[model samples]
Target chain A: MEFNLLAAFFATLTVATYFLTNIVYLRYRKTLLNPVLASTAILAIVLVMANVSYDTYMTGGSWVGTLLGPAVVALAIPLYKQRDLLFTNLIPVISGIVAGVTVGMASGVLFTQLFRFSEQLILTVLPKSLTTPVAMQVASNLGGIPSLAAVFVMVAGFTGYILGPSLLSWLHIDSAIGRGIGLGTSAHGMGTAKAFEYGQQEASMSSVAMTLSAVLGALLGPIAAWLLL
Target chain B: MKYIYTLLHILVIVGFYLMGEQLQDFFNIPLPGSIIGFLLLFTALMLKIYRLEWIESGAHFVLAFLPLYFIPATVGVIEYGKLFSGKGILLIPIVMASTFLAMASAGWVSQYAAKRKERSD
Candidate 1:
């Protein structure tokens, strides 16, 4: 009975919370204030006070996670529609992903190394640039705790969300392709969402960067682990 | 058209679920099945074997709700409420600080590379 009611509350809350966040974003000219992130902060406080287990949260949370399948499938149309543009500008995007993912990972590894962090912790950091679940999995396979990796994944997304545009502005990096691909590639889907705030091209490029970056991160994650270990 | 796209996605997921592990071992990469299959499908299309018609609709649906994936993530923030109030309060600055640092570093590198590419050309 308790579980059922929790699930019910989660279903209601996730949607309500999501809409609420979107409204907040609208009011702020969609500035760095990501409503979803903000609301999560609020909800985390509420849930902790309620003393709910994570498993209980997942009773409802998984619904959102399950949707990832269909969401990934949806990326196909934009890619197909933009097929010509893809091949035309393939070099820059690929170059961007390679450079972005490599630098991000290498820099992270270098930092952890400087601190003389444990191998497991360093491996966890490897997937910081990808999505949470995927990054978690990469960490596990390479002998790190998934939960620790989750830390960096969130950090990575927030990093991208907060600094992506500001850094772009600071560097005078104004090209749509460059901005979209770089953020998407480095930041994943959340970063892509930020890219969309800029324009459709940036959105699509961000998507492309996201997909390619996931693959590149997966491919490179273990290699980095082996060498670092 | 929409139905076909859904089917393509189903096929991609199933195909990967079955053989993705083997392929990952073969390539010596760390990618899981679903992701590897996604890459394979994209590669096939890029090679022009898998037609766009098969993937277009599903891709549209996926892209439409891409933002929703983060819907659950906000809940993640709530998970740390106790820590947030406790010593975990330290995490606020830690997370915020690192995030900004990581973003700046990534954005800067990308921008620098773009400029370098221009100058070299």
Candidate 2:
């Protein structure tokens, strides 16, 4: 009942559920029922029913979010190890990141406007397709709610995970690198997860794209907001 | 040998966070600590300030739970239910669908451009 205990409970619950769900995914190869998605849905449901606010949930959420720094920095080893591949494919990778991030941001703005959403909502929603912390900052700086940006990123990531592969198939693009970047550039981490399942090349490139897209999106999202919105 | 440097992960993360935060402020910007964190680690490895083991353990642990962080946000969407209350459930699907389409198109466009560049090379 106490807020501190309640927040702690949720935090523990978050970590526990995530670990368990991932284990389940490994055993069952996953489905529509990803642990992360399931856990998020579960917490959201509990918090609302209990009348706990976003601030309360964020007490725990922020802790997890803070760890993002270490995890992101860790990406360097994988990326650095892959430098030879990067060197060879540097042109394509850099080009893909630019085009992917630019188009993703532009279209997010364009589509939201088409829907008649206010310009503020447009800025908030435009950054949704990126990773959370970055998405939050992008939204915040552009005068959008960081909370809204967090929500959008989740929706976009899950949407990309659920539908990105099928969409790519529909487009008839088959290479692993293409598929990986396809998911990473458009969908962020969730998309990267799906890409990992595609194969070795898909996973590696997905990681590459995921990292590049996050950095590039962070850099570009605000600029796009200023110039376009 | 290369993997040995991977282990000092937490120190690497802390170092990056502090330095990255400063860099963002110095540049008069709002760089996400995570993005800068990665940049810091990447720079170190690229520059060989610390080897791979220098930060491997912390990095691995943090990445393992990366997906879970999004869970609360997705669930939080339920709060918006009343605001919708069938007023625009249809719009939800439309918005979601359009977002998906645009995201997919963006990815493909990037791929297309990348492939085109590859051919020219």
Candidate 3:
């Protein structure tokens, strides 16, 4: 098959699977089977079964990839919606995010060193806590492969979504604001999705934290890379 | 008229991005055009120059479709299949632990601060 045709086919197939997976997740609301994880897994399996190379998939995939920037800008809407809460908790929220992102970046570097991954991999792991679009840009700016950075972001999101509630409860940090910030700052979009289950306050705060973390992560990403690498 | 309003909102978003692109070039930094655009849009709303109602529909439209956009990039992870070998095997646990740490510390500090403020009040 021609490369363009294959790319188009896979792109359509991937989007369709994501739509279907989202329906299943909505019906089931299972954390283990979240749309992002489930859809990615199903598409990966399909590609492997079809013997399609990643390169071919990405050709048409890039069409979807191009929207990342605009979607990121759209995040400002939620941020704006929560403007009153932001103004009210301005100092504590900023401090919390500053602390969270700092710790998150530092620990990512610390783990990469402890694990003895390559220099290239170090850059990839540094911005793992941000949303995928912002994390990809941060990683690319810091000399990492953008796609690899997306994978790392997904890992962080998945772990946070799966374990966030348990971890929050174990720590006895019961504040809705804190729970939202914790999950959102650490896990990004997926974490915020889970936060919605907790309540409206948690969900909104998660959005706030997600936006703040993305901005702070972007600003701090280069500085962290320079200091660590 | 509503369609035109939405179109105008979309144009405003794209315009900010273009401005952000210029700022990115002028600053000679790694900050993304979209982020800078986000900042610009945020400032505008905060200043009351643009109302949320103007862009809410457009922004929500884009956001609702956000995950679909990431599908291609996630698929690209297959290219790094080699990372699963060697030290890469340890990545998942380490990443999970770090994510937990971030959540714990952030949650702890924020909760502490909020409690302190409440007590003072």
**Each model's C-alpha lDDT?**
0.66, 0.71, 0.85
Candidates' DockQ values? 0.31, 0.49, 0.73
Model 2, A17-52: lDDT tens per residue?
Answer: 778777877788765567866676667667778888
What docking tier does model 2 reach?
medium
Candidate 2 lDDT tens digits, B18-103: 77777877887666765776787788788888687656666776666777666655555665666357543433454356456655
Error of 1 at A132 (Å): 3.7
Q: Which portions of model 2 show Cα errors greater than 4 Å?
A: A1-3, B1-8, B83-121
Order the candidate numbers by DockQ, best to worst: 3, 2, 1
For model 1, residues B40-74, the per-residue Cα lDDT tens digits are: 66667778887776656555555555555655644
Model 3, span A163-182: residue lDDT tens: 89999999998998799889
Clashes of each: 9, 13, 0
Evaluate model 3: give its TM-score.
Answer: 0.95
Shift in Å, residue B28, candidate 1? 8.7
Chain B alone, TM-score of each model? 0.68, 0.66, 0.89
List model 3 lDDT by residue over B1-121, tens digit each. 8778777777767677778778988997578888988898898888999889888877877788788888888887777778777558687787888899888888888888877878887
The reply for model 1, stretches above 4 Å from the true place, is A1-5, A8-12, A23-29, A32-35, A73-76, A116-118, B1-29, B47-50, B71-74, B77-121
Candidate 1 residue A39 Cα shift, in angstroms, is 3.9
Span of ten consecutive residues with least summed lDDT in model 3 chain B: B8-17
Top candidate, metric TM-score? 3
- Give the per-residue lDDT digits (tens) of candidate 1, residues A1-229: 9878878788678767767877787788554557656656656666778887666787887777665543443344455567775676666767777777777777677666665656766676677877665676688788876655665676677677777787778766688877887678667777887898899988888877777777778788878777766
Query: A39, model 3: CA deviation in Å?
Result: 1.8
